[model samples]
Target: MGTFGRRLLLAVDAKGYGGADAVTQRQLQEAIRRLLSEAAAASGLEWERWETQVGGDSVFAVLPEGASEPDLVDTFMRHLDAGLRAFNHGRVRAAWLRLRAVVHFGSASPGAIGFVGRAPVEVGRMLDSAALKAALAAAPDACLALAVSPTVFNDVISDAYTTIRAQEFREVVVAEKEHTGRAWIRVPGYDARALDLGVPSGAGREGATGGGEVPDVRPPSAPTAPGDTVVQVINGTVHAPGSVFGISK
Candidate 1:
């Protein structure tokens, strides 16, 4: 059973999880948990208090509505980025951890299984978005890429509510079956516009050129387990399996 409520959504996924061998894949799993816990601690959110759904190389966390949204974007991101860099430091190339993360807000139901609604689905969409992947890929130095939903961007980050530097966020349009929205992408500590991710400087919010060559956003599909829900990537009305390093529910 599930109850509907306004919830704060957080989704994160490993950057290159599938290519890793068995042991390294396990390590990635551990690192994501630790990094998330640490970043949550640094940002003053209690990880244990969060309703988190964990699975193949990714996580969906539904935070309390009162949790500070601004800090999640700015402080949470900075700490997570730093934590990943530290994890990568002095570590073997095979064990290094990197992530693509997204934050959005909407009505969703917290159920016995996991969040069930368009909100959780949109969180997945935002995390799987092409712009978020490109920003992280374009800046190899960055250990994390963040995508902010239009609701969060408009209500908080864009209006000087946080220190995320609004100018650093590049708006991008993401469209998938039955879903479409404008999301802002950024890599912490790098030149955001240098990646050139749409959002015309002069055209206001009307037209968004996908900047550079938009990568093939066909996300990688993972093998299913006995007790897991898999969210596959769609390639024009057909589900394409394992197209890129990607996501699963």
Candidate 2:
């Protein structure tokens, strides 16, 4: 039994894992371990000691007590992307590994089998969200896509506590199952300036992934089809491009 408190939550899932054969799935399981190990080590984290729950295609981790909030978001994330690039560098297109990650801060308690709490469940929901899945579907060249929960974004990302700029993340609402919440999406090393959103030809869409002519730096003015997401832009509301802004909702 573990005490419940504020802890750093992190999750990573391999893309298109189900379609692969058994050999490929085994390789991916190894890759998941390597990805987390290499990234954590690069970020100066002792991942072995972190409370972790591993699945066939994903890994859920809870940083040990007193974990550094800033490092997980900034350093760990940066290295995760870097590790992904390294893993896919020489592999064939079909053998390459792509990942989706979500970071959040929430209250949790360890249980007999795995983490038993809302935070872990929330992270899972966000991970399964169509908005996040569409993020990867939209960016064919990106190796990894990441989303931070509202708490993490507001407390750490929005406050510039990490090196990643707030504007780099596109704000979107994620509705998966019964859990609906806000999330910020980012694809490292890929340019989303010309994303091909799967929006209708001429629907009543303000800012959607439709028609493939839109970018993610803009805010989601009107809701689009279910599972579609739009980014929130500063609209040049601030004078400086690097200046930080707050989440309105």
The C-alpha TM-scores of every prediction are 0.78, 0.77
Task: List, residue by residue over 119-160, the lDDT tens digit for candidate 1.
Answer: 677777778766677778888778888888777877787677
Poorest lDDT segment (10 consecutive residues) of candidate 1: 222-231
Q: 1-249, model 2: which lDDT tens digit per residue?
A: 468688787888889888888998898889888878888887777877776666678777778777887888889888877877887887777777888888888887756545666777777766766667777888877888888887787778777788887767766754333444567777886543234434332322233433333323224553222233453211212120110011010
Would you list the clashing residue pairs of candidate 1? none
List RMSD in Å for every model shown. Answer: 10.0, 10.5
With candidate 2 superimposed using the best TM-score fit, by how many Å does residue 114's alpha carbon deviate from the native? 2.2
